[model samples]
Target: MSHLSRTLPIKRAAHVYLVHEGQLLLVEERMDDGSIFYGLPGGKANAGETLGDAAVRQVLVETGLRVTDLMFVSLIEGELLTGTRNECYANFGRFTASFSGDLAPTDPEVVGVKWVPFEQVEGLVRYGPPPEVEERNPLIWVPTRDFVRGQPRAYYPI
Candidate 1:
């Protein structure tokens, strides 16, 4: 078999939008330069698992929170090359839900959790580490922020 055939493909993932008050819940990704970037709390599905269930499980794993009233939202998906490995990330039925419990990072990669102001998305996307990464992933915070602020445009690829 060719090397490409031997390589693995990341087929699916589920991320959640957890909002409370005027802020959105996010997990920290500390870059090599010590700058903090944020992403939603969720991950890929295991074999024979459902997306919503995976969302619930991943949220609990990453943030130690329980989510309820899962409502489907926009889907952001495409294929990309990550360090010479071609992977397709298809996130179907992205969800928003109400969460409760004290936040904690059970995953080592998640060093911290915070409720970022909805407005921070603009700056994070505009001035984040390399515009290239931002372009690859759209301004995801927009939809969640709008939804939180009750200004409409909740589900989005913006």
Candidate 2:
């Protein structure tokens, strides 16, 4: 029997951070009941697709942007309670990418897309939580900030 059968269902997700002039591209999505949330532009990788390709495709689909210059940033393993799949554990690849295109929302996953100055994201995130709330909340992040300040990228489980 395959060892996959004995392990908890594992889901792969990519998060693309589109940075330009110290700002980051973001998606604002609405739930069926009209609640709103914020998130980076990315999604699941298709079968046999590289994480880089998945990030590029997801950015274009979710935010109507063509992404290039992708770089791997961090690998995160955590517990996420996404509504569609409440897996207790998930592994995620976070990437930094450069993109160019008219700002628009193309995929149904996003209701709005925009660029926000990085420094101001904390305030915005405080009010507009990410879609995968338990997974992508800024409150749980420390890697990028720490890395910039020459600190280690060690993440403590919350």
Candidate 3:
């Protein structure tokens, strides 16, 4: 078998949009450069876990919020890149979820949780969902949906 065949080429992750009272729930993360950015509460799926389950588990771990009424919204597939080389392919699922609880982040990588007003979200988010996806559901945001397919986008270390 070739070396490439032994390595995993595709990565799978899921993210959720939790909205309440015209405000969206977001997790604050400190980037490598020490700058902080806000993104949805979710992460990569475990080896045997389904994407929906991963979404629920990540939200609870990152924001201390129990997600209910989880609904899958969209699937974004594209190539991940490191400079000019293709690093991997990615499959990201966007979900809308309802939650009941206060903000209390447990993940060390997560600095905190904030409920940002809908009007301010576009300005604060670095990677917003694709235009087509946003048009269908303006309330949801997927951090990896900004790149076009067939074009390599920079790989983000989570």
Highest TM-score against the true fold, candidate: 2
What value does the lDDT take at residue 138 in candidate 2?
52
lDDT of 2 by residue, 4-80 (tens): 34346555667787777777777888765577666778877787887788888888889888888888777766555
On a 0 to 1 TM-score scale, where does candidate 1 land against the true structure? Answer: 0.72
Candidate 1 whole-model C-alpha lDDT, 0 to 1: 0.67
lDDT of 3: 0.67
C-alpha lDDT score of every prediction, in listed order: 0.67, 0.66, 0.67
lDDT by residue (72-145, candidate 3, tens digit) is: 66676654442334455566787788787877888999998988876677677554223222212322333323
Name the 10 consecutive residues with the lowest summed lDDT in model 1.
Answer: 127-136
Sorted by TM-score (best first), the order is 2, 3, 1
Query: Clashes per prediction?
Result: 0, 0, 0
For residues 3-103, what per-residue lDDT tens digits would candidate 1 score against the true structure?
A: 34443565666888787766778787765567776777887788888889999999998999999989877665444334433444444446889888888
| Model 2's TM-score against the true structure | 0.75
- By the lDDT metric, which is better: model 1 or model 2? 1
